[model samples]
Target: MTSWRLSRNSVSELRPVLSYPFEAAPEHGELCEVAPGVYWLRMPLPLALDHINLYLLEDEDGWWIIDSGIALGPTEEIWEQIFANQLGDKPVKAVVATHWHPDHTGMAGWLCDRWQVPFYCTQGEYLTGLVYTRATSEHFGWTNEQHQIRAGRGQVGADAARKSMGGAGHITRSLPTSYRRLEEGTRLTINGQRWRVVVGSGHSPEHACLYGESLNVLISGDQVIPRITSNISVSGIEPEGNPLREWLQSHERFLQVLPDDVLVLPAHNLPFYGLHHRLRYLIEHHEDHLLALEEACSDIAQTAVELLPVLFKRELSDSQIGLALGECIAHLNYLYHRGQLERSVDDEGRYRYLAVDDTLPMRLRKRQHQADTELPVQV
Candidate 1:
């Protein structure tokens, strides 16, 4: 690997007087190989977003990679060290990205170009990722998904919202002009084993996952993680996100295919057992989200502003708060779909929610009804 700046002294080993919040670059020295023919790599990103995991797979052709690091200097430098030390003299035959997120697909284009290989992914993720520069998405709010959020001191007017997306475009590099679309169920070989493709949704469009039964391994992209719950955020582009529903179904799909002990290699966090338990946790988390928002909006007339806090579970700045809007819309939309929440646009053009009669999903409907009963007499 060429010498790059991402690799430097182990600054983490040095003691710190005090740790700053949201340090831009993550510590990159914490890489570990979880299994033979599979290596887990970490690279520094520019926020407290935590370290991103890039996977390397050994195949008969050479080294097959499931995602690339970001396109920043620190990340690039780390790749240089990686290629030199671990992949030295090895060829990268194919590059397959799990989704459109930059942290996972950032270095894909560069690696494909450098190694003269073809990049493959779902067409939607590819096209979206192609135009997905921080510059692009920032042009508008994260998407129409955000515009649907109502607020109490939360809604930034149209002008401020647009300003927030500024330079926020392109979360990841778009697919290069030269690439192949990976079709679901297509068989591929890696590390001398035949693997089948599985597609997951409600996270990114058409995210791809790989399962090798012989090795009892699943290369789960962002679909599942060990620690942090993956955000199934509603983007402006997909407003009618039944993500809560979609994600739960995805969990069932993920659980149905693999055996109990198939090792999981995720895009983030450490490898571990208990795939079913993790899926249950993710399902339960969203279930809580659905219930929490349902009850919060029941007590009073609520807008995106009112429910952002309950949904986000963290503080948001003037800009980042926009996601709260989409979150509100998602829950409201979910309830609306289930016939649990009534909705109508008021004079100012904001949608209001009221609980409705329902028997299905009784847990959510029951709380929503109580909140609805106590709601205001006036809109």
Candidate 2:
């Protein structure tokens, strides 16, 4: 029997409640009750950038914040509003991050230092978050991103990429503070409520998923969402990925253990019920992406960059295109690693891909049974 790898859930059982769309002038972030003691603190990431969700857990001693938002002007202003207005005297015991993403772990160090509280996360998450983010500072701050935009055709994306990078400097202004590592199945108590950790993969390495059994709440932390599928993008580093496979496996992990009625407190979308259904929908989304990829490449195998618009469509705006391209690379890398596609370099030093048999794509090969029913389209 084959051992199943970890993945992201792809079901659509729970849809976004449309709390606040991150528009040009987005709706400001606020604290909302997801479960009994679990609260989501929305943080602004301005103008087509990050819209992060920081969590707070009310406990007997004080509060335990999970995932501090980016440490920029807007994010800090909102954080001050939240910390001063709501959690004034409450002692922030610990801050837990789900992963190393800037949006999730951005202000962890600042918060921990401010409150004299210990930061908590997986060892992989804490260390990687610190090192990788710092190392990529130049890349994000528009220093070298021009190279990211397909070499010669890189003008249109340069500005946007620079803005994105500078935003990183704004968000990730704090690090070097200490953090405590939390492992999978780790249990803790908050204000009398008991919670366990459930880690997910593909989207980010060693991503943590918190489960509050008594309240039936899961602090999903980007592990799952309602409307839009969480991005499983492959970046400059770690070019090899089996994201489709990893995402599929992550969903099964959630389904096999998590109950249907558990309320999901996603890091992005509005919290809701139906974890099982959401898992299935997320799974189906990747499957569909793979199928779409298969169809797009049936005629001729294309490099991940060339095939992105075909998979996601060219209807998206400039920023959306970059994101779509990233996800495209992730899926394509996944397929490549699974041995379905062989990669080569042209004389011009450009990367190209070709399927094994040149007849049918791997996704289409065993897809007759499940592929019969149309899967939901990814936005």
RMSD of 2: 6.5
Q: For residues 1-379, could you state the per-residue lDDT of candidate 1 as single tens digits? A: 1111111111211221221122232246434565667666677667666567677787766888788867665776777777777775778899988897878787787778788898888887887675545344345553442354333332446556555442423444444666787777888877678878888887777888888768777889899876666666665566566765676788888878767577777777666666776776577566666666655555455665656776665788765665566656666677779887777655565667765544334664454454445422210
Off by over 4 Å in 2: 1-30, 136-167, 315-322, 357-379
**Model 2, 1-379: lDDT tens per residue?**
1112111122222232233222322245556665677776778665464577678899877999888877665776777777677875777888888887778877878877777878789887777676666664455543245335432225555555555543444567566466677888999888888899998888877888889989888889888976767888765455455665677788898898899887777877566676776787678667666655655555565666678665664477765765677788777677677775667765544456665644453335445434434354433
> Which regions in candidate 1 have their CA more than 4 angstroms from the true location?
1-31, 134-157, 166-174, 358-379
lDDT per model vs. reference: 0.65, 0.68
In candidate 2 the C-alpha lDDT for residue 118 amounts to 82
Model 1 / residue 104 / CA error / Å: 1.2
Per-model tally of clashing residue pairs: 23, 15
